[model samples]
Target: MTRMSKSESRHPVRKFFLFALIAGAVVAVRNAVSDKGGSYDPNEANER
Candidate 1:
């Protein structure tokens, strides 16, 4: 059998964090779109 190289090793923790970041962004956008204003306005947030 062939041995796996160091670079070929799986990084579960790294992959998990990456997935979480993407998922969080998706959820944030979804929530923003479904909110009362129906959109996200960075300027309005900054003005608060």
Candidate 2:
């Protein structure tokens, strides 16, 4: 028979979801930064 511990068995799913979330955030940020015609002008807010 095989043996499994509670902590060891629970780690993979949690790790996979965490990795997936981080990967998704990275892709989203890359897409946003790569877009054109979008600019952030802090002075406009200050003028108001």
Candidate 3:
């Protein structure tokens, strides 16, 4: 068997974190875009 460099061994781990970050951003954007206007209102709070 052959030995691998430190950078080479960490490459896959770096790639996985990058992919996870991108996926999280995509899900957040989709959730915001698909919202159906159920937002909160400061003025409405006074009525309660």
Clashing pairs in 3: none
Lowest-scoring 10 consecutive residues by lDDT in candidate 2?
Answer: 36-45
Q: What order do candidates take by lDDT, descending?
A: 1, 3, 2
Give the top-scoring candidate (lDDT).
Answer: 1
Per-residue error at 9 for model 3, in Å? 5.9
lDDT of each prediction vs. the true structure?
0.68, 0.65, 0.66
Candidate 1: regions farther than 4 A off: 1-8, 36-48
> TM-score per candidate, in order?
0.53, 0.53, 0.53
Q: Relative to the unseen true structure, what is the C-alpha lDDT of residue 22 in candidate 2, on a scale of 0 to 100?
A: 100
Report the CA-based lDDT of candidate 2 relative to the real structure: 0.65
Alpha-carbon RMSD, candidate 1: 7.0
lDDT of 2 by residue, 2-44 (tens): 3456665667887788889999998787557545323444454
lDDT, residue 2, candidate 3: 38
Query: Compared to the true structure, candidate 1 yields what TM-score?
Result: 0.53
Q: What lDDT score is found at residue 42 in candidate 1?
A: 58
Per-residue lDDT tens digits for candidate 1, residues 14-40, read 768888999999999877775645546
